[model samples]
Target: MRNGKTIEEKIFKILTGVACYSLIAILGYIIFIIFRKGFSYLTIEMITQLPTGGYYYGGEGGVLNAIAGSLYIAGGATLIALILGVPAALYINSHLIRHKKTQNTVRYILDSLWGIPSIVYGAFGFTLMIWLGMSASLMAGIITVAFLITPIVIRSFDEVLSTIPKGLHEASLALGSTRSQTAFKVLLKQGFSGLITAVLLAFGRGIGDAASVLFTAGYTDLIPTNLDEPAATLPLSIFFQLSSPIPAVRERAYAAAAILTIIVLIISLSARFFAKRYSKSNLK
Candidate 1:
């Protein structure tokens, strides 16, 4: 053997490390940019004030409305995604699809949908909602987010359920259980951690999405008076604010981005909390 390794080994190692370090560096740049700009908007008044004139008038206040809209719309989408994706994943994983052809077709379709651009999804929702006269309504944004989340949710759920021991599924069937009953009582119980991860993934995705909601969820200075009305979400507001040429708007965008990061971190951490506990108990 030539000394230690071939050139390919060294190349591969270098490439992998460079790829990983590149990602870390990019993330570091983002964090630094957000914090450096965001601190400018950290004042009590600035945090509370609504978009106003160049001076930021004393009374018009806070991103409380945007925050609420984000939570409501994103939460609604996750609910819809879970309802659709979980059942679909369960059916697919339960071997109920029967035909390999049909299963592959569905899986391929889902995989393709996952690759669709978020802005395209937003435009689609906007057009569809406007056509249906539900423009700027909560329903529009909810549906858009649902569309974005469904593929990811289905994939995650399928992975988890697929990873479950096939023996358990077969044993349940052998003991006179129906597909639904077996999945509900045994496979689901076992795959609960993965289901949780899927949920976290969905929540994280929904909360971070902006393009999908940009047109669907119309920007409103006032909070939504009813579900039929338009609302401003954190991400959309951030996008709009960031696009402005003003330094203040840019700073506000950075703060909103940091806030978005924090929210995602919390949701991920909570999901992992249950996972860690489940692992410990299973180990014991």
Candidate 2:
């Protein structure tokens, strides 16, 4: 009986190991394919040149304008999200909301926004921007992306905030720190690692997002010389060019896709670095 039980345990361990290895192998294979097919088009031209007339024109004239627009929009949204979402997360997690009904209502709104489709967000942004007389503009794209990313940041930050121990808050009070200081100085400082992760996650999503900003942030391909002007992003440019009938146009699209992939990879790696630095520094 003892030998039989030991054999059963070994079998279970082996199966678990095989399952984990298989999952990792599958993911690695997919990434390999993507890199093989999509990386060759990443060129200096693809990074610097603007899109023109359904074709990517000139060497070293890649997606610079699109990349700039994407950064600007994502940055603007991230700034706005931090201003509102972080404090809200702190307030809610710290139980500063005395009214149960109001807190519940606000939580529901954030959660519901997460469930809404990305296309709907774009459509709504276009309608709102046009009604405001801006049409398809960079600011419109920023606001639309901001709205989509805000709920995610709020959710992530709230979870991080919740992890702060009750003992920490109580100790802060014992040291004569007021409620505000306890939250802002004590809780936030301690939760900094998680907050950094939240920001990075939101940024990654914002930069990669295509559908929600497409209609509002009209693809103009020209450099975004002014806030009120229409401009193309890498993702939007890829979409428009990919639909073209010409082979050169499609090649340009492929190149743009490769560049976009590189941009996303950069952002993701940066996020990991940030998370690691903050986590290690704060852990001590």
Candidate 3:
């Protein structure tokens, strides 16, 4: 019996290690390919200048418009998600704390929403745009992306808040603090790092999701100055560039992909740093 148990444990451990290493290898391969193909073409001109006339056909231009548009839409969407998600998460962890059934139901619904395909969100946003007499513009994209990421924000923050000791809640209430105050002041502080991670994750998702923004954010060559103007994103830029027959255009697509990858990497790193720092501070 002891020998059998040891063998079983060893097998599972080996399997887990294999799985972990496989994922890391795959990720390393992807990063290697993107950079190897893109580094040569990713020039200062590509990053700084707007696409020139006939730019898609190996013209002199950059993807600055796409970069700026992506930042604007993702940043706006993230801000909106943060504003809405934080309060909702706080409410769930505070008011609904005692009601396990209700809390679970809400979380299940959020998880379902999060799992829904981004294309579905695009279709829904398109429908909503027509009904509201809105065109495909930056505002439309921001709104659509916000809707897509809100559930993620809420669920991520809720999970964090849930992990906190219930004694903190009880203690705050015992000290004569209102539920609202306790939820915001005590719980929000405890879960601050998680909140940052959730927002950055949503931002990364919003920026990288071409499907969700394809219908809502109409393509544009120039950077949009207003919310009502059409915007371009890096994912769309890469898609369009890759579709071109020109080899240079294809190379540019890889470069755009590299840029997108780097942005997400930065967001991920920042999240880890902030989360770790704040977690330590909270502990202290």
Candidate 4:
């Protein structure tokens, strides 16, 4: 039996190592290709200047419009997701804890929503836009992306809050604190770092998604100055550029992918830094 267990352990270890190395190899390859092709075409003007007339035909222009529009959509969506997700998570944990059936049902629904494809959300947003008589614009994109990430935020925050011991809740209430007070002051404090993580995760999801915004945020050359105007996004921008017949235009696509990758990397690093600092302070 001992020998059999040893064999199983060795097998598992080998599989785990293989999986880990496979993932790293794939990630490294992607980064290498993006940087190698992208760096050659990358220029300060490519990021700072807006696309000029006939820009896709190897013309002098940049992706400023896509960058600004992506930020606007992602920022707006993250704000909306935070506003909705936190309250929903709090409600599930603080208000509905005793109602196991209801809580489970809510969780099941959220999990199901989370599994739904981004393209479905995009299609839904398109139909909703038609119903509301609104044009494809930044606001539409924001709303769609917000819906896309709301379930993710709520589920992540819920998981974090679930890790807090029940004893803490009982003790807070035992000390004559009202439920609402305990929830806001005690639970929120304990889960603050996790809340930040949830928000960042949702923000990353919102910013990275392409299918959800494809129909809603109509492509445009100009930076959107209002809610009604069409906006471009980095994913779509890369998609368009990469599809170009010209080699230089295709190279610009790699540059756009590199910029998007950098933005996501920065956000991820910042999240880790803030989470670590908050964790330390909480420990103290």
Which candidate leads the pack in lDDT? Answer: 3
lDDT of 2: 0.78
lDDT of 2 by residue, 1-284 (tens): 99999999999999999999999999999777667666665566667666545444332356677888888888888988898888888887665535668667777887888788888889899889979988788889988988889898898777667666678878888999877878889878988878888898888788878998988888765778777887677778778768877766667677777767767788778767766766566532
Regions of model 1 farther than 4 Å from truth: 1-22, 43-60, 97-104, 274-284
lDDT of 3: 0.92
Candidates 3 and 4: which is better by lDDT?
3
Q: Positional deviation of 188 in candidate 1, in angstroms?
A: 2.4
Taking all chains together, the TM-score of candidate 1 against the true structure is 0.84
Name the lDDT value of residue 252 in candidate 3: 90
| Over 4 Å off, model 4 | 1-20, 175-177
Task: Find the 10 residues in a row with the least total lDDT in model 3.
Answer: 275-284
Error of 4 at 250 (Å): 0.8
Winner by lDDT between candidate 4 and candidate 2: 4
Q: Give the TM-score of candidate 2.
A: 0.82
Query: Per-residue CA lDDT of candidate 3, range 198-239, in tens?
Result: 888898899999998999999999999999999999999999
lDDT of 2 at 180: 80
Per-residue CA lDDT of candidate 1, range 158-266, in tens?
8767667677888889999999988778867887787888888888888889899888988777667677877778888778777787776666667777777778889
Q: Which wins on TM-score, candidate 2 or candidate 4?
A: 4
Q: Best candidate per TM-score, number?
A: 3
